[model samples]
Target: MDLFSGTTFKRAVAAAVALPLAGGATLVAAGPAAADEEDYKILVVGKTLGFRHSHIDDTTRALIDLGEDNGFTVDVWDPPNDSAGWWGSGSPGQPDLTMDSTPFTSAEDLSQYATLVFVSPVDNTNSLNPATPRLLDDTELAALQGYVHGGGGFVGLHAATDTMHTVPWYGELTGGGARFASHPQQQTATMRVESPAHPSTAHLPAVWERFDEWYNYTTNPRADVHVLLTLDESTYSPGNNAMGEDHPISWCQNFEGGRSWYEGAGHTDASWTDPLFLEHVLKGVEWTAGVVEGGGNCVTFPEVDAVVAGLNTSAVGDGVIAGAIASLLGSARTAAEAGDPATAVQVLGGARSLVDHLSAAAGDRDLLASKIDDLVDWQTGLVDDGPALDLAAEAELRTMGGKQYLAVRVLNEDDAAVDITVTTPYGSKEFAAVAPTKNAYQAFATRLVEVPAGEVTVTATAVLDGETVTEEVAVAYAGTA
Candidate 1:
């Protein structure tokens, strides 16, 4: 029987090729080699136009080892030599190190490799010398866009999120929207595996404790991509705590027509040598290389534009209600324009609630409410937010005597004393008299609550005079009681 139409004749001939040996023994033949036997080609691009990592060489070695151990070929691309005078150091006694000076100038040049891995590519960080060359030019950026949209694969590590800021297309290719804002000091923190079934995280524990620079992204990409790992803010001290509770440390997405995976875990040199971390990276590479089957696609660009238009349209009209809606809409628009879509989404949620309250105030409640709903729905779809709350609070996970507890620190910017209520999945507790410090706009209040061992969502509510503000944060607990 013929398995395939085009290969029937070839199969028939091969089947009839059996012959007797010189010793009068019949020879048995084996089938064709499997597809896995073929070697996969990978391109490791570690070209930093800004702050370079000391572990770049180690990362390259780890990737080379991963390729050798697996059935793949690794080609490391360093930036300085590829662009020549476009990138170089002014210091003396510098070896002027370069790895494979071949430039990726076009889509054709990029097509030869199955996937591209970026290791801490930074640009324009050195203010002393403003003439630092960028890693990707206009044409090359266009090529990368075309490549990813044409079903290429991309894996970004550490400062890959920090690179190619000037090029919007590059950002979109490497899951751009949410850029690196800041990172706390290198400390040990627990990471919750959002997608344990994912090949990149299947071997990881439910809660992974690792030491590295935990990045606090400017905005949460959870609304845009499939988050694979999230840093438990309560597990470690977050310097800025800008992202609040839901902080995504690593995520993957099937962007456009290509596969994209990014992990913010490789800031230190030891990360490249860790078996678990290396395995995680190797699995990401394999997935991008089409060796594995998983990842998420993003919302279409046209859909996002349509939502933005709706937001603009809903902000129009004439009335006191309209003026209030317009004011809130203006705030949302400013946040989005300032490259903080997360805040914009949160503000829009407040705007939606204000519109809801205007049902009795609006002259045409039905018509105006419908328009407002459409706008809120469209805008909210592009970004994710928790409950709308004015005050910000920090929740820290703690354990003592085998009992898991949450040490929540509340910050109130309001002048009046606010009554705070902290609720855990296990139970709820209230803290009274959270007052601002003397002559300071910030106030601090601390609360400790016992929680069951597992992942739990903690909600903090603050009542000022009469108005109530609520915010919820999730924390992972790995304790006995």
Candidate 2:
């Protein structure tokens, strides 16, 4: 499948159109409706398949206001009370969908927005018999995977980590490296800002306290994701899923070819009224959408000082190595405090040379070295030798001479090359050495199936440098039955 996006086609429809909200409300922004046509737009999906939050509407309204005032507009795909498109209550219930009047179902729909925001959209993870509305089905979610892998932006709030717990990709995309386990009662608690330089936390106090349902993740996301806020367990009773000390509450990451930001707060309607929370969310969306800049890294001086101080200097017989490391970290802290994270990263990089001295002396060299590298990566937003290895697929149903056929296109939309294999129930094709370019598409054609009118999915698996990523696109085949 080719790497085409809806943003390209949205240009023809641009002309300051009116976006529909749930409850028949209308919102108009300053620029075009499509995000990539120039003025940025956000798509918020508030439909819940699990225990629905009462604040979903409030959350949607708040985002609309944010976009209206922040040089952008908002389009919502909120199905009121139990509304689904093809799965249930027709498409009319989903008003002002990001993709015009359609439900937020596939990558084609998601391609129009600069950023996709999930306001506590609980996917069908906690369902028992599927008697109610459900979130994206398999094909829909597969489309979302390819969308994000092709440089899309995503933001998750509240129970988003709990949405698709069974899916490894969604868990990593929203949860960083872990999923939500449980939450305590809604109470006022203190959250310590970790990444003071991040847009979401820049205006927050070092010890910001607020009232909300505190969620505990299955594992600490600190090791894999750039952390912004950590909950202070001492301020509240953390129930069963208590993360003792390093409890990360909010974080952001540069994942695959997309940008992601997730926050565990926003469980209450009151959070929508809170100015701090609003600003935090606005900045997060802006950052994820590439409208603002700030590497979620910005290591605070206190955090760096604490990590260095925690090192066991006992391995060094004398205090020389310890003193030297301390001096370098001190300089880093100074640079960080002076609002020069770039200089701080450089100083930290220079300190890497001193880590070799610790290695020779048999100190905690590995720990220091790894932590230093993590700091630098967070600051520079660089991963895997500074290159993205992403493969994306786009598929369409083409009819030639009264007979229906499915055409596939694959785009190596990143900096590393991959060998792609497209598989379907009817046919499969292999493309070798797909170059790392975003503008080209590799095509293949097949007669989808013997059926008359039904849906089928095409899955593409790309492997490069010992890493494998799979993307899927669904095409519906319909001929005069």
Candidate 3:
């Protein structure tokens, strides 16, 4: 069951009890029991030892606003903006959010956040203040590394790649095996949407022309990261450091044990107010921080899709890593179709190294293969953990055109397909031969248009494991889109 048993992959472990959370506003989060445990609070580290961006305050304000609307709170840790890190005077207080001026002390401080944001942090070696020791000292850098290696979330904006560039691993981790080299003048350039399905790039156009500072990296990141957006060198002058045909602008990756998302834009102060850019930044935070409500996983497991698309039978070797990934993908899909999300998710972790590995062969552990196992887990989790259904059966109340309607969504989350029947005080709906990893849905009109938000009960019946099973629970009817 050890995925990294050798240079090559082996079989996978099975899953035990599972209770995956649903999608949308109904998505359930393992919340903090006390104020000391803040899972939804994000720490934005804007400490700069070099040139400080003028938009740092604007970015923080925008992030706070976004967090208020979304489900998270924004905490700033920028000594440059405000040693205390809170915008006490200029910004309006958000009552529903937790706005704190916590300092980034150590690795322990990093644990308090769902994700850590590096907003235009300058390189530690570039000290502007002779008295200041600068950012990410040896202790701080080690802390950041350990935090990321232990399943933490990291988001880098604009100059984040420029920060911590003295360390090779830090540079690669921040920019996906590439370092920020240089940039040209600020101008309008075209951006190409490489993966429109990604939450950050979903709202973008196929060919987007925007005015901002464009960055060029020393090496291409496509080999290490799942690129979401690419830049067209033809649209603008990339200076002498042009990356030519395949320049990556924005990307996401599964690091050693966590998730990292980076973007090469967000330089101008105007970008903070831009609707497209805000949505991109908001979703990036949501995705890296364990997929909050209404958000989606960032990485696209190419390995899984290859199997689904049916790779040539002659192309796989029984002992190769790619072949093992193929086997694992099949097992996971079978588990999902059999309504065993646990087994499916467990199996998917074995194929993380195989993602984007177009050249991996048998018995060879191409170092690249072991980098994205958590990403594989994420993709597998979405097989049935997608936005629609998070569990077996649930009821929701949706509103459209000033009328209320009851929505019932059902998923096969057991080990076998069955006949599912969902009932409520309003009516009942039946699903015939519902298979595993599949979904069924029905809606009934309701007269609760003027009613306040409340919970309603639903009865779900299904024959699971050769036994007649029935479950009744009160479903929340409020906050449906």
Candidate 4:
């Protein structure tokens, strides 16, 4: 049995409306019959074994609209059984489907479309029958494997992971298996972006707050997968899924020779219609169908604003606070890259106020921290780090390295050795200063540093023959805890 049982809408009002509209009466009978046909071909594999009416109905309508707009043919595969049922009238206004399209029964049937959309159910978790009927049992699995391996695209929406948990290949293909360990019975949480450079998320807001059943998967095989969006725990209750600190809500991965994407936030009817949420799904679908080249990361103005605000509030006013905030911003950037936006936001939010006030004060320390925050945010999103180059800028930061060390590179010039100073929370240490004889642009680079789990500051000052040129840039470092 599939995760959800389908319900028959024997007398649904939508069915009545759809009949007349689909019969060529909507446009007042315009254009040639073939010219009016939709373009893209999509297969919406509805509930066959584990079916849900609401899920199918909502997603089906959305896909239909997308197909019409994007020129795709939508074929819904809905098969009926005694335990689970299909909804659609035999005619235009009826409640039962006019036809039964069971693509899972044969490979030939499944090959009719270019892309296959999985909308929830696979097998029954609670079954009474001796022989279980799975969506990708014998025939459908082979067809799907061939389709994707042959370059066919796959899209999974909302409860896609909720299905096909029993199949190892399916689990590997989707990057995880079903485990409804802890999900919010009601919805209210923020979805943040851990990766901001991916294509689908370029336009998405940093934190997506909505109501829906959030699924916590058994395993998150997303370290290597391209993560588009992540769930922030501070926004909702952490459920049963024992995963990392930051959880993934949407992601795309390359499977075999095919592309696949899964989004786990569409369990409600409202989600299907919300313009923002719907837009996200549309982007994902287009990406999977090979219509789009790359997806932007899920970074939004809100998250960035939040970080900015956080820095202003915490450590931007006082010189000491400024120095601390700069270090914090560095740590936040590291956390963001490590797929922990919550931690990144937390670190930034905690220090925003201080940094803002310090910047107003025009204190060198405060300005330095503010600058660090900007650089960190840019680095996390793969944006430009060099803004207005402040030659008058001055900051003091610490660098701790054993084998791997820091190097500085100026714009349009060769790499130059940088003279840096390290300051522990307790004291300070000075390293041998390697001064450049001539003027060329310079930037900093360093390998991953392993330090004790504590806060440290790194400051760099450019000196030319005992005279200071550029202001110091201070960066905070938080060692592994």
Candidate 5:
């Protein structure tokens, strides 16, 4: 039985409206009379063997409408299944694709389409489900890979990351540098356009706020791909805060032999109707189809260097500690300039440790701390090193002697003897010798202190390698128990 022999194949090749090009011009596909007809065809696959979104059908219709407006032909394909039922089951305009066989049974069938748009093609979590049919068998997966590597285009929608978790090749092909870890409650948050020059984000504002499920990736993709949009974590309650302040929501990259684009937005049905969002999708489609040219490659070390230099000028302060930080920064820049981003990142990591110690010692919290954080973020995004020191302070509420106290945790990543001195508003304490361990350099030091109800500045000093470095941090005290 031929899978696409019925209405499925017929509808897939159904004629679409002429595609409109730039300057109000339209590219008409040659009619049946022509021996070789050239058509701009798009395939939208919304097959999900796992958790499905209610907006899948709506998204498909929206793309079809876009095709009509832009002069291209779109074919929407949803897997022939009703095991879990549709989003709005039994409702009018709901997609009902029925087929006796699979459409993507061979490479020849899949190669007919030029651009492939995956709208949440999720797989089941149970890898051992023998009864359930695999979305793309080994052959089909290879065919799709060959197609994309042969210059075909791919655009992955919202839950694309949630799909194909078992297939490692699919991850690389879709620019799944990071898997979807989790998402917070659907809320409105500001999205900063990272690559305004790219076609996908060129129409977007510098900072645009929209409501959707903001996702946190298991790994940050900024280092491996060109990020188009980043969710401003400060603008919303980032549920887990896993990706830190610089969270990327959308990115694009030229992967393998084809163009790959993925955006973390589009979880809601309303998003399909949004003009700006639709335009963004259209631009990505056009870019993948070779209609527009930009978003060339992933970010390089030089770009990271430029950002680091700017941050150093604006954020770094003055002191003996500051001088040491400046020297480390210089060395990192030199390493990067010499085409050693890994070494640069390692040196930057050491600088971050020094900054963390300084921030704890001097009791200067906001400005210098923020600057160091920015530098560390940039450094982390440039390379992948295992088990490196992430210098930062953590605060926790504690009770000491039947009184409320703020416990501050200052961490050090290196394995060296560090001399620590802490000065609080109440009194000063010094630890002559702090031993190093894998967990922390100063494990025995008491970061907990008692102060009046309000904000109080505390200074810490660390003497290491015969150099004295100091930092200050402001601690807020609620009240005594």
Candidate 6:
């Protein structure tokens, strides 16, 4: 069945085979080949102009690391740097990822491998002459279509998504297209995982904060792609965005006949250093190579509570942008303080648009979203509504004479100074003590006191507003008063 003919054919094609490297680039990668079967054979294709060299190098290194860890051989394809056009003047020591340096000519060359990683762009790129250029034409597309249709794998990093928008079919193959409709400011921001079970993210940290260029895709992928991780908009970014409420930072899909994944989070050298991010990229490689299974399904933000809260780039000044974000944050904070958890949640949820806006405006978004994630935690956990705090000290109680004191501190500084009250057989008394002002602080004074001998009941309340909050710990006294 032709995978491109109909939706059912596409579904059948997706389920029939796993990720396989494709094309003529497989001979150059280096690694220990699996048994006779060679479970994982990968091809890293790096050939483009004006393409950032750091991203290509980092992605190649990351693939090598994945192969080493997972027991697979990687075939790196570095065509003559001269063929890379104006942007091809890369520093030496690169273009040496693998042993193969064959010039990629057709789709048949690409079909041999199980996975194909496009590190650079290939559209109207000219290396030899201006009139004559190396472009992906009908034959190339047919070959690529066949490779993936036969269960091959695909992965694109950084600018790969920036290529081939003029060719509608190529854009569809990439799940995104050339030239983002919006390019937001670059800032450090968090990438929250939406599909934790997939191989590409099994070990990735729940929140990946790094710096990179978040492209505003010309042809969005939300309709047909399975979003894995997204940029939380509570932080700084473009004011008006085309990606809508949930902006995809990383995702995977069964395209043509193969499992594919692409991440928009690899624009910086520093980002390559993050172990978690490296692992994520590695997992995608592994999954595409069929060493791992399970591509994520499409995910949507159902409600406000589902959005992860964190700090991002909204604080950076752009005057208008900053002012607007401040207004939103102030509103969320006020709502939370006014004992309106629902209202605060909604306000904070809406703040995601702020992040999208700032990212598009700034032309860089990775760090920006990360910054927003940080701030969101402070505001969203309005009165402890954020991610849970490990504020409870060791279960062991500290002994003070005959008194037992249980130490508890706010998980975050923003949650500090909350009202706390203790209830006992004598009467209900509220203790006024400011919460620790730092991210983590010790409150040794907050302990459980044994009621004077023979007291029947003891209760403690930790309050954020009008009601008692903390868990109740009962203290039983043995002796008579």
Instruction: State each model's CA lDDT, in order.
Output: 0.60, 0.65, 0.63, 0.53, 0.60, 0.52
- Expressed as tens digits, the lDDT of each residue in 193-228 for candidate 5 is 765546677568789999998888768876666677
Q: List ranges where model 5 is wrong by over 4 Å.
A: 1-39, 82-101, 126-133, 295-481
Worst 10 residues of 5 by lDDT: 5-14
In model 2, which regions exceed 4 Å deviation? 1-38, 81-109, 127-134, 295-347, 351-481
Per-residue alpha-carbon lDDT of model 3 for 139-233, expressed as tens digits?
A: 77777777777677888999887766556777767756676678899999999976554567656777999999998887898766777789999
Stretches off by above 4 angstroms in model 1 are 1-37, 79-100, 125-132, 295-481
TM-score, one value per model: 0.52, 0.54, 0.55, 0.52, 0.53, 0.51
lDDT of 6 at 158: 70
Write the residue-wise lDDT of candidate 1 on 172-250 in tens digits.
6566476777888899999987655456776787889999988877567765666778988888899984577788888
* Best model number under lDDT: 2
lDDT of 4 by residue, 1-481 (tens): 2111222112111111222211111211111112233445667766645546365677778878877876576777655545543333221211253135456554455544556788765455433353666666667688778777766667787767755655677776665443334565666978886544444565666677888788777667555456677877777776666355758778776566666777878878877788887767776666566555432222233333343444333432454664665567667767766756556656766566555555453434343444344333433453222222221111222253453222222111112334455554444555444443322222233344543433334444444345543323333333432
Candidate 4 lDDT: 0.53
User: Global CA lDDT of candidate 5, please?
Assistant: 0.60
* Model number with the top TM-score: 3
Candidate 6 residue runs with Cα over 4 Å from true position: 1-39, 81-95, 98-111, 122-139, 176-185, 239-244, 295-481
Native-to-model Cα distance after best TM-score fit, residue 114 in candidate 4, in Å: 3.0
Worst 10 residues of 4 by lDDT: 24-33
Segments of candidate 4 deviating more than 4 angstroms: 1-38, 51-53, 84-99, 104-112, 126-131, 177-182, 242-244, 296-381, 384-481
